[model samples]
Target: RLPIKWMSPESINFRRFTTASDVWMFAVCMWEILSYGKQPFFWLENKDVIGVLERGDRLPKPDLCPPILYTLMTRCWDYDPSERPKFKDL
Candidate 1:
């Protein structure tokens, strides 16, 4: 099963998915890669993910993730879909 942590707030709350949502998922995939496939939000239960996301929380940078990469990830998770970087910009 895919981790709930990869779902964007819009996708979770309103069933909206778009390229911006794909950007969010890509960020989570990057986090997993940085952490050697470690699951995102491993400490949280699946049911709690949406609430945490609604609260504007996001996964912290992995210890080994480069600053630039983490910055890109955070941008991808921006609450406003329009604020996310285009895939070409990544």
Candidate 2:
């Protein structure tokens, strides 16, 4: 899920994982299940994940996924954590 503990420890210490991150993880998990345990970002390196995350980008979801679900998944990866939906809404 969201790595709340994986934040940077700077002087300002604005390090905190949010619900958005959790949603991202959930989407990743869904992808894994849909692919039957196939690797995610297998073709991409770890840095790619970081880059996409930093840029508020998400993995290209499967076309079979319903549009509603896909939209929710993308919302989970929102750059602004506050813009993310809550668990209840998810």
Candidate 3:
């Protein structure tokens, strides 16, 4: 089973998976890497992550994360898949 923690909003909500979802997963993985493997949404249950996203919240930028890179991460988490940057553009 895929880790819900790494799932995109679409994948979690409507079972839609696409390149954009891949982008979201990549961003999350990057977040983990930058945070020294800290788990995303560590205090929330698997189901709660979706609600958090629907409420327009997201994983906070790490204190040490560069602003520009955090911008890219937010882009990957955009609610609308079409607005996310393609892998080629990252």
lDDT scores of the candidates, listed in order: 0.89, 0.58, 0.92
Query: Candidate 3, residues 1-90: lDDT per residue as tens digits?
Result: 668989998999788999999999999998998888899999899979998998999999988899999999999999899999999999
User: What TM-score does prediction 2 earn?
Assistant: 0.68
What TM-score, computed on C-alpha atoms, does each candidate reach? 0.91, 0.68, 0.95
Q: lDDT of model 1 at residue 52?
A: 86
Alpha carbon lDDT at 62, candidate 3: 88
Tens-digit lDDT track of model 2 for 1-90: 433222211201354445555655676677666666767667765434565456555666775777787788777656666676788987
CA shift of 29, model 3, Å:
0.7
**Candidate 3 deviant stretches above 4 angstroms:** none
Pairs of residues at least 3 apart in sequence or in different chains that clash in candidate 1: none
Task: Note each model's CA RMSD in angstroms.
Answer: 1.4, 5.2, 0.9
User: Highest lDDT among the candidates is held by which one?
Assistant: 3
Task: Give the higher-TM-score candidate: 2 or 3.
Answer: 3
